[model samples]
Target: MATAPTPVRHRPTITRTAGDVGAVYQFACPCGATGEEQAARRMALVDLNEHVLSLPKVPAAQQCRTPRTHGNQLWEPCGLCADQTSLFDLEVS
Candidate 1:
């Protein structure tokens, strides 16, 4: 008998939180991953982007395609959905 493969969790979104004046900035992912505190906002953003890029890529076909709403308007083909499609296409070609 073969063991079943573990289900892959959707990539956790990472966000950067602003710190008090003179305090260092920090970035954290919902998956419990975190970055070292940095004195610059740019550094914090870089850390967050790096974490997102490091996660395993989900196939475009398997990614969520749900419509997203911004303000009062509904965005057909969510930005994330578009990005995943483009990214996957790049990897395949």
Candidate 2:
């Protein structure tokens, strides 16, 4: 007799939500993981990013780079890269 194939598992999506108190936020994942309430939205975003990075088969954040516009390079780091850096810095501190 042929054996049945195993079901595939999908990664949970992480999202940020406002907390009960004003100016506070937290992140939750479908997998039942949650972040502690944070006063700064940036902290919530960092928590979400950390969860994403912990999952299997996920790609690492891209390196920071200045984008060129009309033959001139912008002075700011890419938003995604900046966020990624901030997440790591927070983790280390």
Candidate 3:
């Protein structure tokens, strides 16, 4: 039987760590996408945003790909909207 190909995990990731000169910013994702080092935190975030927006939009399967990670949340049939913010907003009060 034909099976679905392995799902390509495309998540915008920003990994930053300290270095000799200063802090190093890395814009990388599971889709094998990367960028040059960014010295500014804001710039790195911008890079991440651009990369994320450029990627193909994931269907509303109750998944969160932002910041590149398959969050531990499942799609619920609750009457709430299926937008990204409504699904992954941890600070929901």
Which regions in candidate 1 have their CA more than 4 angstroms from the true location?
1-21, 65-93
- Each candidate's clash count: 0, 0, 0
Task: Quote each prediction's TM-score.
Answer: 0.50, 0.42, 0.51
Error of 3 at 14 (Å): 1.3
Residue 84, candidate 1: C-alpha displacement in angstroms: 16
Off by over 4 Å in 2: 1-21, 58-93
The candidate scoring highest on TM-score is 3
Q: On residues 1-93, what C-alpha lDDT tens digit does candidate 2 reach at each position?
A: 122233122233334455567667777765677787788878887887787666543223333353443221122224565465667665552
* Best of the candidates, lDDT: 3
| Global local distance difference test of model 1 | 0.55
lDDT at residue 59 of model 1 (Cα atoms): 46
What's the true lDDT of residue 92 in model 1?
52
3-93, model 3: which lDDT tens digit per residue?
A: 2245555566788989999999988877788867899877888887787677654455434444224342222111223354456656655
Give the Å error, residue 36, model 3. Answer: 1.9
lDDT of 1 by residue, 1-93 (tens): 122245333233334455665767777765677787888777877887787677655444444566433211121223455556668565552
